[model samples]
Target: MSTQTDSKRRGQAFAGAFAGVAIVVVLAVVFFVVRNSDDSDKTSAAAPPPVATQPSAAPAQPTDAAPQPSEAAPQPTAAQVNTPPALSKEPDVKGGTGRLTKLVKTTLVPGTGPAVQKGQTVTANYKLVKYATGEVMDSSWSRGEPFSTQIGVGAVIKGWDEGIVGLKVGSRTQLDVPEALAYPGQGDLRFVVDVLAAK
Candidate 1:
């Protein structure tokens, strides 16, 4: 009976300690919940006054210069033979002299005569055309230079001899080469010649 009594007292003391620990845990939980509720209420009540967000001003518009109408450039064609601007009509004169009548039907632009001395170096540019057809047959202009040839040395065509006579230096002349002077056995021929230099 004494041993039974001692065990019952011990049991009672253990039950009381367990009850105190449970009470402490419940109080801590309640304190935490009450503090969180107060903090939430204060934040909700004091939401910062609605910030007046101003809309950004539109970016400055750019000013542009008006477009201009451009002029068209000159164009060349094959039939026109525009190697250079259609050579402006050269002075309209026969033998380029106020006098001489043009022997050939077509127009001619001549270089002033050069008194080609006998056996001198004569640099000349020439365009030869068949008088009947007005078609160019041969020309020194093809070489792009006044060709150098000996005058009165029997090396050049006969028409060059007759046409070159009595020509002053730096003179431009048109020659209506007669059949007798050029290709006598053949027909009439037209020659446009420029005497560049004579030595």
Candidate 2:
């Protein structure tokens, strides 16, 4: 009976020791799991969220800035100044009657306004014809506009520069331009011109 009792006591002690070791292992595993979960939460909290990009709806408007200083506006050349104006009715002009020996100027109607000056802009209506052919070559009346040119500045034929300078604003002049004073290759020509305005 004493031997059986001693054996029973030993078995009970070994079973109790096993239970303690099992409880310690389970507690260690639980602590490790909790620590790893806390570390993951800290890492996630340190990072920032990503930003999204978007496009604008409209372009920026221009500001009203002051203009910078520059050179004076360039003056119009002879060709630009001489562009034909709107035309009027045709006049009764007779040409090709006789040969022209030199530049001839005759004022048919005297002007009541100021006489034209050199380098002044002159607006006039003219009819041009061949001295020998009575045939009309060009007429501002036929065209829809009167002609504008700078007098005595070589903007027109030499005869016109010389003949139109002294003519008043309302005068009518007849010019017989010989080949020498007219176009180089063209023959003698006749012109009846009405001065409209000069400035």
lDDT, candidates in the order shown: 0.47, 0.64
Best by lDDT: 2
Instruction: Identify the leading candidate in terms of TM-score.
Output: 2
Off by over 4 Å in 1: 1-114
State the lDDT of candidate 1 residue by residue for 39-88, as single tens digits: 99999888876632210110011111101111221111223221222222
- Which segments of candidate 2 are over 4 A away from where they belong? 1-89
lDDT of 2 by residue, 147-175 (tens): 66667765556777777788888777888
TM agreement with the true structure for every prediction: 0.42, 0.54
Instruction: State how far residue 39 of model 1 sits from its true place (Å).
Output: 99
